[model samples]
Target chain A: MTTDALALPMAVPAAGLPARVRIHEVGARDGLQNEKATVPTEVKAEFVRRLADAGLTTIEATSFVRPEWVPQLADAERLYPLVAGLPVALPVLVPNERGLDRALRLGARRVAVFASATESFAKANLNRTVDEALAMFEPVVARAKAEGVHVRGYLSMCFGDPWEGPVPLPRVVRVCRALLDQGCDELSLGDTIGVATPGHVTALLAALEEAGVPVSALGVHFHDTYGQALANTLAALQHGVTTVDASAGGLGGCPYAKSATGNLATEDLVWMLRGLGIDTGVDLGRLVATSVWMAERLGRPSPSRTVRALAPTVASPASHKEQ
Target chain B: MTTDALALPMAVPAAGLPARVRIHEVGARDGLQNEKATVPTEVKAEFVRRLADAGLTTIEATSFVRPEWVPQLADAERLYPLVAGLPVALPVLVPNERGLDRALRLGARRVAVFASATESFAKANLNRTVDEALAMFEPVVARAKAEGVHVRGYLSMCFGDPWEGPVPLPRVVRVCRALLDQGCDELSLGDTIGVATPGHVTALLAALEEAGVPVSALGVHFHDTYGQALANTLAALQHGVTTVDASAGGLGGCPYAKSATGNLATEDLVWMLRGLGIDTGVDLGRLVATSVWMAERLGRPSPSRTVRALAPTVASPASHKEQ
Candidate 1:
């Protein structure tokens, strides 16, 4: 385009700022946990290693839930040993003190406490009220913090709840405040059912700010069930939330969710960031190929549009649009 | 959200402004033209009537193309008569002078002309060069004008060509200008392969503006291939473009363009508009239900996320946080 064209009223800036955001790879834990087929522990470990090699700084290795609840991730013990000693930080999900005990015994340096913002969701998912769940996390956070392990708290269904209706912003703020007060170094607000619009993201973040939660203590996790995940993430990034949770190959769909939609694909996120001149250390081609490999292993096509669009065909890539 | 939290930045003004925009529903024409199964003419006529009932003033009815090429829409003759005398402005696509002759004989009051920006695509689809295709439209546009009929020009492959690589913005602007100069009342820019990004949309519209084409004279047509169609359309709306072209159920995908994805679903576009408080005069739930019907007829679920999420579940319109 000519310089005259770029000078239009809404001219796009070069956006030279580094996309220094950290992507916490969640495919290993959140992704495989929902799969019907159990991925081998060695395969899960290799997935983590590949993700780290692709320049991801953090990886949610595996959840320590009971085997009866999540048979796919039942071999977390075996998987944790193989992924140990990686340079990247590994955080595992702990539903309660028992799950925390498993991670702590396994030498976990970081652990995440999971809770939902809605009473119905919390009751259904964790089988406890919000207060009771927060109360249970008190011991888990204290133990992990005393052991010098960072504790990250997750508030799921913060935007919209399935059993109930629209979650009140005050309720979300209270949950965020509770998580912060309970010693979570950072809080990742999850649109667990992927019903969030950009406006919802902005409104929730604004309420959090008003509640005196520092922006630095926040991350955003989005599902792509409604196809607003990327747009919602952009809203969060603009609000200065630096950490994002994404599943590789967009592998995971929420077990509680009815739709077959995929999570936000890491390759697609990296592609958008790179286009904006954001510096995500993750290599796009390698990540795309790795995601394709994982999809092959799961006997499914990759859920990522970017991966599918970028994969080679009989026609050359150059034949496709450069944009 | 609190008052302070509610007041966020604005790129586009709320739709309550004095300016009234028009939405041209292309579901019946551009949408079904590419369907695998031939839609009965009665179904096509009923779909047009439903769209008109949904407050869509401009509904594209059918294309006067050869039955051998587009078998799905081969019964345009039968369908056009069914929608005749409707209060809505129903336009039909005319491929050439021969097609225009058929439309004129059928008393088509409003007609649309088509041209491609890329030579390869022009040759592949229309069996002509880019210049030849535009030249072919010159007579069609003239005949429509002489017959006191309104003419709209469709410039396909504006952002990227499926056969050739990147289509330069200058080339797209030139084609758009030529079509406008050919006595067409409006210009519709199509991302036929769905390769457009917001940056591309911004840059191209800016180029058109710099070329002295009134932004209000342009409409946007996007496909959801990269999942950026809505975002790209939002970027266009930020400019003064008042019209957008969309297919119901995300119905249109180019069969000639291998791996090309679905068009921007009318339901999805309506959802975004309603979220932004823009008045498209289209009923969200009814549009979604109609799209679901279309999808069922095709024996395929919709390619639109909004239709899939809203229909058969969301009983009421959710409140918009932005509003």
Candidate 2:
């Protein structure tokens, strides 16, 4: 890449923003889970190691869901242990008691349970009602906490749902309270459909605060289906949310969502945070190189605008080494 | 498209934002200027008409520069008369007195002069020093004002320059003041290389305000090269600036910049504005259709994330009719 394209933005810190942001990297698990092809277990482990090398403190390693459910991430058993010895946090996804048992058996220290804020998504994604799904996650979270493991509750469809149009604020707040009450150490609100705007983001954070959920305990996971992810992220930062979930190379779309777009790209998030003078502890050059390498492994160009812009020479598969 | 994918974000107005935003549509001028393939004059005229039909009040029609400098927009004279009778305001770009004369000959009521904020960009883009370029625009702005015509001054490279790195705020403010002092009706601050962040945007606007420029007299023109345009636009909105410059369907790239990404997509901007309950009088569905049609003419998909998500089926050439 030319020096012009690789040059970082000038740092100018804004008011009412945190000095540091903890980026919850989700590329290895949430990103790979939606891929059609089966990535090798060794490749997944290297990807996590590369992410940790790029200075991301928390990287979601793999999902312990049943192999048939998300075959792309079926190698969780082999993947977690490979990256478990890293200095960074390796959080894995656990669907229920069975998944929790499998994860705990592998000596996993950090785990996240996925929940849905809307009824339609809960039924469509989990084949259960919202309450039933929460009932399933309650034990998983409680057990993890009892084991002194950090628990994260991922509340999906918090902004808009595909089957149900605009999700109500109270509906999302109730689910968030349920997750926190069941002992989730933190919560990641998911905009699965990516229909959220800045005002909706601000309003949701405010409502959650009014409902007794601390802003410090909340992280936002916004998809870029409508190109509102970074803008919504800025609103969350303005509201004192220091944790943001992003995927490397903008990988992983929601299989159930109508749009095929995925989570906010970590490279894009890092560019903004670095420009805002917020400490992310990320080496942008190294992070971009990692995404470029992963994009080659996927045999497709990255969906991230930042990745495409910063690493134009190596972004496409035909340009360099083949998978 | 499914209704779920076409769903609009819920209206949740935020505090400290303007009640309405006036979008300065530049697909025909700034957007088309960098095209390698020549779009037919008839297609350009129809694109402006479609943008007006989508409820954009101010549309920049074409630039009246020498044909050799920008062969893509060489049909400015032919394209201007075709869309001049529309109800919306059609502003054309003029690089100098000669270009301004050509525009005035066509009874143009609104014209814009493109200026550079940094010395390096001024030399590279205008072939003159910053002061020399300002001196050139002074006469052009005066002539337009004497004719009772509205003039917009575009200050490019206000945030970062390719050769100069991050531009100082005072340097940008000085150029903005110069443009206003020369009797320009409004100024559009251009992040030509798209390196701006929220804090930088806020800082630049505040600096301009300190230099006696009213927020009402300014517009923000952000590029999405680094995926920060919408966030920077949000910061501009939060600062109470109501005018935003966007390209229809995310057409146009800066041929001078290293990255090939273009302006912030109008559909993306409208999505955020509509969600914030700020009136821009745009119909999102119709706008997406217009962009899709223009993308077909360009023989490429639009760079806009919103256009891709909203009008997925029609954004590609193979799916529908051939140009």
Candidate 3:
């Protein structure tokens, strides 16, 4: 919002875009869990702290999946208390009652339940059928609500699954309704394979709205795997859906970090939103600095185009002659 | 377009989206020219041949710039005739009458003149001021028209120049009008530094339209350095512009390829257009293959997210054990 000379080129906001969007930062949980290296518990906590200091109001702290399933996040128990005092809503991923119990013990305020719209992705990710996974989350959601916890349902593969291609909108709507009916306060429709386009997003949001789910209760989770994440997010925003999930620096969570272009980079989204004159309450400069810090720790450049653009001196070590 | 299961997970065409878009393939000219390695003359023609085979109707063959200025595209005279027989419009870049003379002798049906919109870029790239560059191309465009060769004008830095913060929309409109008035059939607006967002694209397109430059005469050239190319392109598409300039596999020509993340990848654009159910005559599979082929020659992976997504096995050699 500062008229700083280096700020992104700002323009008048187009009609239909949200005046302000809430970015759900998933760097700690989704970004790191997939990373090849196990970030120290202290580093993970610092990552959360930096994200909050950068003006992020909602950050997914860590996932409570079994250590056997996600060894990288095995230190979630250690990660939780470290970030508990940050002045932000730190959410954690909880797949079942056992994971919910872990989050409850950590005094977590927000928890997200992960589900899939396709049978193949369900079986592949959760080792269960789609219906079985939904059934499994019922008890967890109930207990979380009973304990006054806010629940966010994540519908992975809501757009397409690697194994299933394009998921039927009706199936996604059905799963979404079930999650909302089961006490989830909101749903994050995920394009797990990064194959979604803006038209598909508009059509799907319309279907979800027609099926009686308010647009207010929906957020979008996209992967930049196909590079349409920002465009897809724009379509969703134009549909009046305000909350979007992004990972800082487009992190793939790979410790080796050769191919780390998974989640939409938060800096990219903020750049677009800020340029369109929309408010996100997030500071682009601080976010880029955070990614730069994390990339150093990971021993690789941040794959985020926005982060790299803002901090170009770090992306390439070689020099270019300036005219 | 086929109901074949692999047709991009397309939704019904949304309102305001063009049913069909003409993709101007720049892989051979814009892509390879900035590449660090000087691709063989035969391979340059082959790249254009492949792009046309992939259903690209407009492929810019090569630039007729001085060999000393662009050694990589030094074979433009050698490259033209090889692709002249193709059932596509082969446009070559002609900076002035000398370059136009090379195209004329080679029987080029279509040629493009490169101009800079900002004074700084004009002086740096064309070694002339903005008006001086426009004046320099006036006769080149006129002579090309007299010879019955269609001329396209490229106005670089239409949005922002690296040395200049944001080029005024009126300035872009004036340059665009001058080109169109100078007998140019179409003008492609180039965000040479890739700093534009959808909002800026929208505003600029609106100003251009208001200045009486028909939307049909406008094409957008974007760089993904900040990862906003597709989004900016979408804004132009929604404004009813039909031509889009893209390089296969996101190739950045090395004349300054080190800074060339400014062009949108053809595959990434196709994925969005196809998913939007917008008919682009280009084939996604064939385009990805072309990029993959070029990447091998370049000894690097394609920077395209769509190509990387389609050819994931090579991109992520690290295995993810399937259930």
Best by lDDT: 2
Cα lDDT tens digits, model 1, A1-323, are 11111111122322322347888889888888888977878778888887887788899999988888889999988889898899999999898889999998999999999988999888877899999999999999988888899999999888766666557889999988988888899999998877666666877888899889998899899887666777677667767787888988888877765653577888767755654456678877667667766776799877676667655431233442212
TM-score, every prediction: 0.86, 0.97, 0.93
Instruction: Give one digit per residue, the lDDT tens place, for model 3 in A1-323.
Output: 11124457555577668899999999888888876667899888888988998899999998899998889899999989998998999989999999999999989989999998989878877999999999999999999999999999999878875556678899999999999999999999988777789988999999999999999999999888779999999889989999999999988532212222579999999988988889989888878888888888888988888887677543332321111
TM-score of chain A of 1: 0.91
Q: What lDDT tens digits, residue by residue, belong to model 3 across residues B239-260?
A: 8989999989998732322344
Top-down DockQ ranking: 2, 3, 1
TM-score of chain B of 3: 0.93
Which one wins by TM-score: 1 or 3? 3
lDDT of 2 by residue, A156-200 (tens): 999888878889999999999999999999999999888999999
lDDT of each: 0.77, 0.90, 0.83
Error of 2 at B316 (Å): 11
lDDT of 2 at A254: 86
Measured against the native two-chain assembly using Cα atoms, what DockQ does each of the candidate structures obtain, in the order listed?
A: 0.16, 0.62, 0.40
Backbone clashes in each candidate structure, one number apiece? 1, 0, 13
Best by TM-score: 2
Q: Residue by residue across B115-186, what tens digits does model 2's lDDT show?
A: 999888888788999999999998999999999999999999999887888899999999999999999999
